[model samples]
Target: MRTRQRWPILVAATLLVAACGQESETPDVDQNAVATTSCASSGELTMWERSGGNKAMVDMLVEAWNTKNPDCKIKLTYIPHTEMVGKIAQGIASGEVPDLMGMDLIYAPQFEKAQQLVDLTDRIKDWPELKTASKGHMTVATFEDRLYGVPLYADVSALFYNKDLFQRAGLDPNKPPTSLPELRAYADKITALGGDVKGYYLPGNCAGCNIFTVGPLMWASGAKIEAANKGDEPLVGDGVKQVLQFTRDMVKAGNVHDGDRAENGETFHLQFGSGKVGMMGTGNFNITLAREQNPKMNFGVALLPGMTAGSSASFIGGDLVVVPKGSKRVADAVNVMKFLLSDDVQVEVYAKALNLTTRSDMVNNKYFQAEPLVQDVAKALEVGRTPYTLTFFEQINSPQGPWLKMLQRAYYSDDSLDTIISDAKKEMKAIADQS
Candidate 1:
């Protein structure tokens, strides 16, 4: 959740006045002098966030802040997820960074290492409200024994199926696939329909999404990115190979699309919406887009299929709010963080934005329970895992990343499972070494 709106000048002036006069013991200085002086000198709190459909939620929070603290002003900026890291790095180097900003959990460690983020550990420890918040997500925000940010949203992947397509394939619409074998069987049945239709669809170009959705397939098989001591080479385990081969099988079976058209921005939702795909692995956000695109389509969501060795474990992704080092408004930013974590605001913002809540206590809040898919996503959060380390973002997103290339080769080329996996291990080793 990020924004691009300009800072509120009035709010800054108000905060400045409160900061200056709250410490004054002089009876000679008029309150108006405090207000005017503070207004004239107070700087705006600039914040940067991702530009999605969640702008309204940020606006509502800022509005609420202004209502409660009329003197503090906030400036908002919107940065796309793709450019957030680069822009923030440039801003930090120039000493012109914002007071507050939203960062992805995967990339937060880099900022923390750069010494550009404020340590919120003390505040978080003292604040009971934040302590009981989403401990799972907060784990990502904490690094090197200090908390650097507060998670703002929770996102987890789940299986979304076309109920109508399931019924057409002679499957029960009410019973979604719950295991890997069952999912594969259902996909085969759906593909048998044959007229421009697919059993499943996942974008070959989406490395991050694949990690969130397809990565689970490997985890379900009990494989992981191997970690080793000293100079030992990290390797992909058996489960990793199994999932990679599974993806290869899906592409070869005509159950999924792998052409250049799919590579050029064709989303899984579009294929599912058009009745060309019967099922997809997606996050909760996809539900909104799918409903908007095809109101008449019948769909149901369920937990990702479990593997023989591994339980269903999806990847969790979300944004975190951080205070920059040396920010003049560190105290105020902490206050805002606490407010955002408050039960009332968390519920309000999550209710309107349709994003999952990071607070454990808020998981069963009435708002989330009202929607079936959202409820499934909330449950998925209980069992989800993030990439093992912060470097996971760069490792997977870089041009030479193993995940993207592995996915592409599997989908677009005739490379065998062995070759693709051998190449992936080398790439993963390089990434681990760099880290």
Candidate 2:
């Protein structure tokens, strides 16, 4: 969900040509080369990764791989997450795609369906290590019962609370809200503190912020913003209305920051990190960032609550490592993926950095156990879900898309809730059908 770039529609014609290269007589590409389960004995590899928190982790893995096998060295390039999809699309069009690419999971279906990703179903299906990977990400990486990628790292949304704010407000620091009613009550209590302090904060102008954070509330209560099956309409259940109403109520109560309505995600986390906000909905990457920004700030993390007390969910947002269709070093790229998934990297590297590992079994490692905040997020990642749709970027992640329009109207506008929901379903349905 940290991905903020606007991506253009992947030209269907360009992808078709990229998947099946031109009939050039040049020897650079082998027309008959195809993805295989076997690993190359030696080769050079090029991989493009998204920048941000994940950059250091990718760099470490690449260095380790190069040290282990100098013959199969990987040349890594950092691309802004915002520019990743469009750049990849352009790369495909120019027949210059990377051998390995770490992409946002939401775009997996789009590329997989376009035949621009290499199928690794047979390669990883029986690999014993595959059983330990995040099942949620694996679901997003699959299309038509075939695998195209593996989880590179995970970033799921959860509720972040300021412990000091809670204690100063006379609320128990250890006890965070677990339901919609409790959340509102907590927000009101915190907001009562007055003077530059706010009970809750959300990047009102950020579609990714709302969807990755607010979306879990709807999902925990059994609602959906996108259809699971292609061509089906989105199921905007009572949960959806309830979540929207909850946000509207919070706004009306002045429990949210006055400036939040105009704030985008660019500095939302920093505001929370400043120690004024009582609660915020954001991703796990902030766990380390919050500490770095304010070393003394006592914070707690928990799953995003549902309408009721006992239910919770999170947005399973992260990058997936995929080998492009025309990659000449598919085997070498996959070998890198395997090395990354190994426990040595998943636990020692990622978990030690206060990040969630792609493998669920590694959640209880020594590093996570030592940090309750990280542990709580690890639990959220297991139960989180990523929306499965080819039009995810266009219909939801896009700033100008209908999803943001509906979300804006739901919270800030004077429109009726019924009208907002109705219009949203229609717009989402139209986009879903286009896929």
Candidate 3:
């Protein structure tokens, strides 16, 4: 859920927002045994992970890593999720880097292009857990035919609704809308039951969040924004425009929060967490945060509504841990990967943390089977795809990127839908064609 999940942004100047964890540090020395990609011996390993939502869980694992293999002595530091990737790219040039980086999948290709990460294609095949990794998770880190990162966990977007609101509106809590028109109707129904609560949490700004928010709608509509990781341009077809138009109509209906247009997605987390919003397109991780934030709030999750009833799609996102080329402990990093992908660690993530695991094999775990919200995520992942391509990283994810700009206009502009789609397709293709 790299691009698709909501990370609490820490830095105001950049898109640096995400919930994270804190940790210890390590040193640089000649790691003579680094050639052994096995976990038999010990060596100092340094790693950097993004901070926010998943921080505590990750910290728990890191603590276990240090204690379980004291000789390996792996030390970690939490970089603001916003700062992790950019800083690491800078670190590559400055020659100051960590042994491993738990990074967003969308950026892997860029690092690979810069020669900042070590390709684990050969080393990765040796790991059995890899076969369980989902296509969306692997799609982010794969460039051409090689893998550069091991997905630590996964995130998928879903339609999250306030069960209380649904019941009050006379809607069935067990049954959620599965098409865009039905979703719109539900939003209107919830809104009609006047209160401080809004029917839907729509984003007027923040393209960074929309990658999964509205992005899922486009995918569900059978729109191919582009080829998996490379293409001449994103296919801004009728489906994409319909999604934008649907949002526009909803915004016109005042189904969203009062100040939704002015803020980026970061605010929705607080709103949804507090029970002010009824429905929001969100990742699996938010299930825990919502409960912790408002224990009284009852929530239900379902597949994001598609264009056609029963049709489903979601954007899979999450961090992929990669080894930077400068790190001497490549072997130790492999060991770290081994432990991370193990049943002990992943089971905790799915069962206790209620977060999505990168391994598809965990889909049937009794934990997810028991939790409806987590199950919604698993179902989404089974059919989910990542909105990544090997090109135009800046124009897509950047604050000033073309994709965000298109969304900004789509949600806020007075222009016609056809005009917006036409202009957006041109801009996207222009940026995509860049070197």
Q: Name the top lDDT candidate.
A: 2
Q: Over the stretch 1-435, how does candidate 2's per-residue lDDT look in tens digits?
A: 674644544353355546445421212323233423234656777889877646777777677777877877888899876567767766775678788988878778877777778887876776667787877788889999999888888888899999999998999999999998899999999999999898998678988788888889999888888854457878468998898899998898988888889876778667778888999888888888899999999999988999999799989877899987667766677677777788888887788877788888888899888987888888886778888887776678778877788788978987998898888888878877766
Q: What tens digits encode model 1's per-residue C-alpha lDDT throughout 354-408?
A: 6677776677767767776676677776667666453464456544467678777
Evaluate all candidate structures by whole-model CA lDDT and list the values in order: 0.65, 0.79, 0.71
lDDT by residue for model 3 (46-128), tens? 88988763676677777767777877776888887656666775566555778887887666665665555777777676567
Compared with the true structure, model 3 gives a TM-score of 0.86
Using lDDT as the measure, name the better of candidate 1 and candidate 3. 3
Q: Candidate 2, TM-score vs. the true structure?
A: 0.92
